[model samples]
Target: MTVTPDIVLVLCVLLVVIILFIIDRVRVDVVGIIVMVGLPLLGLVTPQQAVSGLSSNAVVSIIAVIIIGAGLDRTGVMNRLARLILRFAGKRESRITAMVSGTVAVISGFMQNIGAAALFMPAARRIASQTGIPVAHILLPMAYCAIIGGTLTLVGSSPLILLNDLLVVQGKSYEHFGMFSMTPIGIMLIIAALIYFYLLGKKILPGCKQIRERGPLSPLLDKTYHEVGKIYEMVIPENGFTKKSLGQLRIRANYACTVLAAYNHVTHKRIVAPLSEDELSPGDCLAVVGPPMFVEKLARDFGWIYKDELKVFADDLAPANAGIMEGIVTPRSALIGKRVGDFQFRRKYGVSPLAIFMGHEITVSDLSVQTVSEGNALLLHGKWSAFHRLKDQNDLVFTEPIRGEEIREDKATAALTCLAISLFMILVLNIQLSIALFFGALCMVLSGVLSIDEAYLSVDWMTVFLLAGLIPLGLAFENTGAAKLIADSLMHMLGVPSPIVLLASIALLTSFFTLFTSNVGATVLLVPLSMNLALSCGCDPRAAAMTVALAASNTFVLPTHQVNALIMRPAGLRPIDYLKAGAGMTIIFLIVLVAGMRIFF
Candidate 1:
């Protein structure tokens, strides 16, 4: 093969892109955009070709897949799956780890692996709290399995979904892969991972101490707000404060007491974070958190019956349903410079402000009147559902991971039907993958499973644009004969190795590329090269191209992968920890990948 000026320029651009990716200063998506614009500037690809990736089949399919996943999430399908896993997981650490990790692995075969890992993270933490296992032991295994599980189906990972497109662009006689073409090898890899973790986890996994079984966030809440106040229940007498709304009494303003929940004994009604206009009728029970002296004074002055224990409000105000949480006001929050009372925080957000930790000061009184600022940590008490809603908003961010019943359980069946329709179209009807998935996503929006805004919010636009921008780079590799140049160089170095050796080498190279750069970048850069290499060595080009696609998901030795980074902060994991576990997993991944390719393909 002859190396030309176009090939040299393409290689130079590729080198710069890889260096920029490794430097980690600029965002990966920005690097992708650089590739998108840089190639056209260099005249390596035409303007039309440069922008072709934005409308490509792979990018469209990924968008649809994300929306479909969100629809299922909104309808509580993942939550139900988590519950089913817990029902059978038992109390053993190894069993729980295997069950959760395996289930996530299988789920990742259909949707984005990072999404699958995130969906199961809270469940893994819940299991760790219940089973006396350190979350460190469970999270890494789950993350690892999720990465491996992406190999199960074509649409499972970005790389695999982009494979057919790259192959066709190679303009070879290669056939496109079916959705489940890689399932046999993927199943083998998943089983191998489960067995490896179950057998050697205690020896190799991190040994971080377990948090309190009550839930990790509980202790943090107690330590931070222990000085704020104590929870007390009070009952209203027959004629005490009759027909007077809570606003008229001005309890928070005068007494520094916040009513968290109200239970009416006569109507058997429970209102959490009751509005200011809610009337204080006789025989109503109030769940309030305040200073003991202030609470006693209110009881004495108003002739209200006081109780040392929460009897009627116990279930309503239980830790599982309602508790104190720390919420940090985002820098771009709408609430900035405004008082908490300006937005009617209690009525709108369904959370009561207990104390504001601003700078070094902790303000407990007149919380509604206190001005809000960026990064102000507000200690709030409310139902988990309220915190969950706040998480969706950008103004206030919760510090702790919350488990709440926020899913629309009523739309679950509709979501499932939509998913079934998508699958049927793909497997039976033989429709285009992107078209089938998009139709399913449209069904989700039309069926009231998810609002249009929610569907749009579900997409990680960065990933979409990254894939879109990098596609043209792969086209340049093929169009400029850069792929052929590199393939000939590699073939000369290897001195005509066997077909299996060729496939293994391609897998190893792709695995290394994905660790420093992104899996998507690695796939786009290598698929064309792999096809050329296979042809040069008299090997099966399809197998070689597939090798590059599958190996892209084998990045576990670093925290560079999205799933690894997602779990790192929560698990208190460091680089050395990933190296410890990922080394063995990486070796196993290669072994299974090579052997499975030889046997299956």
Candidate 2:
């Protein structure tokens, strides 16, 4: 039989989506928009039909959730929580891993997983530096916990939103999922994950030995620039420096470093305004910034011994060790199209490229071998000595130094306020209003809880636009009648009289597609087909639709399926890590989903 024009059009569109996803050529959102508009031009869908998916409740809910997440990130509340957790973690690696992962999972249950991960990352890095623990030991668990936590709530992740929309469209009218619908399963998964980490996470993860040997600040300490500048951490020893008048020492002329700030060690209040010459005292911490040479000379002249061995300035010095250098592959970064092994990074820059924050998640086994795309954040590592030299080179864009205090302080009240707004929108108002979530996020910015620039920085606009663009394409599948055709074929092949078998088939296929393509895209494509299949089998279409929708989000086998993959790279992970950790979870989720659909739907 000759295939219809609609089938041919859908096949072509599917091919494009798959190819674009694999090649990382255009942004996925752009690709999605093209398919949505292009299919209509080909007479496969009407303009109205193509635009309908944009109105999907799922899409609206997701946008709101993202905005709400941005608000929480702005408040710096999460950072405070991380610090408190780290303080209580002690020195036991396994206990630390459990605590960090557990806390991340719990918080992510109510907020966005990526938001939680971003908030916790700096603290994790700090703990790693202070305790001489390799970041690898904690980061993977951190990412995994976020993923598991997101599975708990309807507002936690996009897949849950998609599932609810699919059910509504199928006439089941499942407006909301219970807060704890997935908690039992999620909690079980966490317990299992903790056990696995205890058994194998330590052995496979990198150790703290390298960090200890290098010293806490060794990576950032510019050994080559002897005395060019001095970063002194003077406790108000005898209050002499504090008591000395600014004019007496001529700090600006003598130190050559700007007096960045002064904090009264006793009061902990920062002295931002100009200090009166007579206000000098003995008990304050002087945060001075100036030429290394001048500071070094002054320190010697003043009997200030350089205590490089002390951890007093540990927080301030940690970023230097974890050098943040931004480099565009000028079609020649010694990294383009090369794997990690090819460059032998430790021998070259004395650091590893931790994470590549990109506009899209694409695979690259070797950094040197993979073709570099524009706008990718290559998180590089190196000794401060080598990084300074690298920073001077024209090939890489060196990021401005980020203050440790700014990062730590950024984690305050925003998360709580955002949560309050989200809860009000979902539970109290009962309006199903996504704009409320956005408004709540906006409140954070308007109230000075978070600065405008900081709020903007917190958003993953690429992902947002990608979703916006892809939603339209779902219409093409429906308008073209391609969905009906696929549904017929599926029913003929596997649609037995039993609804359970049919649901399983749809769920399994949806899960497979999700592993490779965007989960939202996977859902938009499969939901219509599964709905039709359910009708053909004389079963509730909502159940089948829910199966497909839920399955799309359960990508635990590979990093490619979810945002968790992007977070994994900085933790120094390999593909096998997902294969081991995510595989069992994927299986458990599938079992639970299938059973839940049978009983609930």
Pairing residues by index, what is the TM-score of model 1?
Answer: 0.58
Compared with the true structure, all predictions reach lDDT values of: 0.78, 0.57
Stretches off by above 4 angstroms in model 2 are 1-3, 25-75, 88-101, 107-183, 190-224, 227-317, 320-415, 431-433, 495-506, 510-552, 556-601
User: What is the clash count for each candidate, in the order shown?
Assistant: 0, 34
At residue 322, give the lDDT of candidate 2. 34
Q: What lDDT tens digits, residue by residue, belong to model 1 across residues 462-500?
A: 766666777787778778876656645765787677887
Q: Which stretches of model 1 miss by more than 4 angstroms?
A: 90-97, 107-147, 150-185, 195-322, 325-382, 386-406, 496-503, 509-587, 596-601
Which run of 10 residues does model 1 get worst, by summed lDDT?
A: 209-218
Model 2 poorest ten-residue lDDT run: 216-225
The alpha-carbon root-mean-square deviation between model 2 and the true structure, to one decimal in Å, is 14.3
Winning model by TM-score:
1
